[model samples]
Target: MDKANQTIQITIDADSGIPIWLQLRNRLVYLISSGGFAPGDKLPTVRELAVSLGINYNTVSKVYQDIERDGYIASFRGRGTFVSDAYLKNEGSAENEADSLIDDFIRQCRELGIPRQEISALVERRLKLTE
Candidate 1:
């Protein structure tokens, strides 16, 4: 099967002690929230995803069920699973929260004695790399 056709990308990290389900949930939430998968985008069936990821089908189903319960996706019988229309409902709030988190990170760095100039220079370097 073509890898590009799969909507979900699952990876097992050998080093991290985190449970596989939590990792899958985090990746999916980040991908959906970041617009990597737009609203209404279809996801692979739980069985197909399990087979592709080499994980148990029950694990894939549980992750999907949890995400759906959290309002991040909608699963319909026969129609398949899809990214929720509500995904973009609070985009502004999400942006504001992200900004606040970054602000907190910078403040913590300063509290830890990271020089302001050094921080600014590092940020500039990162921005330049992205550009």
Candidate 2:
């Protein structure tokens, strides 16, 4: 398969029971916010991504449609899809908010008895393995 057809690696817990589409969308948003897919970057088409991930086309399309509605991506007929310009201006603010939210979530996880080192280890492992 072409690299563009490769599946996106999103970190989600299957047992967490979150809907797959939401997980996919949120990870895409995180990528956009982090400049992984910057403004004007073309997104893999629904058919391409679905085949790569071994998911139904309609399922990935649903996520794209919802996110496009949310203003992260702009779709053009017959021209493929690209990230929105609005995303660049708003991404700074969104990244700040996301960072704050993640920090709070980590704190909450600690309060709930999860170890910080475990989280750190997982992040480190992913960083190393993905590289």
Candidate 1 lands at a TM-score of: 0.62
Worst 10 residues of 1 by lDDT: 1-10
- Best model per TM-score: 1
TM-score for each model: 0.62, 0.60
Cα lDDT listed for each candidate:
0.76, 0.72
Q: Ten-residue segment with the worst summed lDDT in candidate 2? A: 1-10
Best by lDDT: 1
Which parts of model 2 have CA positions greater than 4 angstroms off? Answer: 1-6, 11-14, 88-131
> CA RMSD for every model?
8.7, 9.1
Model 1 lDDT, residue 117, Cα: 92
Point out where model 1 deviates above 4 Å. 1-8, 90-131
lDDT of 2 by residue, 1-131 (tens): 23253245655456677656667777887776666777788888889877766667887898898678657899999999888866555555867668755764575568668798887886688789998
